[model samples]
Target: MNLQDLQWGLMMMVVGMGTVFALLALLMVVLMGIGRLDRKRPHLPPPPAHEAAPAEATPTVHIVADGLDEDQVAAITVAVMTHAEHRRRLAAPETRAHAPGSQLFASRWLAVGRGRESSPFPRERR
Candidate 1:
């Protein structure tokens, strides 16, 4: 291609790149301004706390223990507690500590790398 044609292409490339860069910078500035305005905007005060109702105003539930023996009651209580603990564990969010396949490595740090693991001790010369 001619030198003039190459120069025109370079100019066009520069203008296109500059336009994209300018637009992105302007978007960043507008977002920052919006954030600043949001911070400055007045917020409604927290709702006032209402006093709790008197104990006498609430209804109570009673359980009869006449039919259940001590052993049966204890068994039922254990079963209920175990079920609750199981449910709690199931409902909890999965953490990195309990990630699947994590058990293969002794530590999370050991699980990541592109090459052979490094050692603190100096290697023996071949």
Candidate 2:
């Protein structure tokens, strides 16, 4: 492309980006002003001074295993705990120990393979 055309493209890009930035700034300013105004005059009416607020009840869970023996209950608990542990292990595999004398990294090649393996991002197969 000609220099004049390239210059025009750059100018247009700058103008477009500047407009977006300015609009975002203006929106932030407007929101801040609204927040200040809201604090000055809150919409919610103040609670009545004469009436006492009702007490909140805390909910409780009651498990009823009508005919199950203690042994059966223990067995079920063990099964659940084992399954949970298996799932936890599968979700997060243990990282291997770093090589001797290279505490921060795992290799002499300067590769961060171990750190990448434990990262939240999924790895793609090479």
TM-scores, all candidates, are: 0.32, 0.32
Write the residue-wise lDDT of candidate 2 on 1-112 in tens digits.
Answer: 8999999999999999999999999999999999888786546877767754456555544454876766778899999889878876765333235444556744544356
lDDT of 1 by residue, 1-126 (tens): 999999999999999999999999999999999989888657789898777778646754444497776677889999988987887677644323566655655655655432235544555899
What is the alpha-carbon lDDT for the whole of candidate 1?
A: 0.75
Model 1 stretches astray by more than 4 angstroms: 40-126
lDDT of each: 0.75, 0.75
Per-residue error (Å), model 2, residue 105: 62
Q: What is the lDDT of residue 2 in candidate 2?
A: 100
* After superposition, candidate 2 runs with Cα above 4 Å error: 40-126
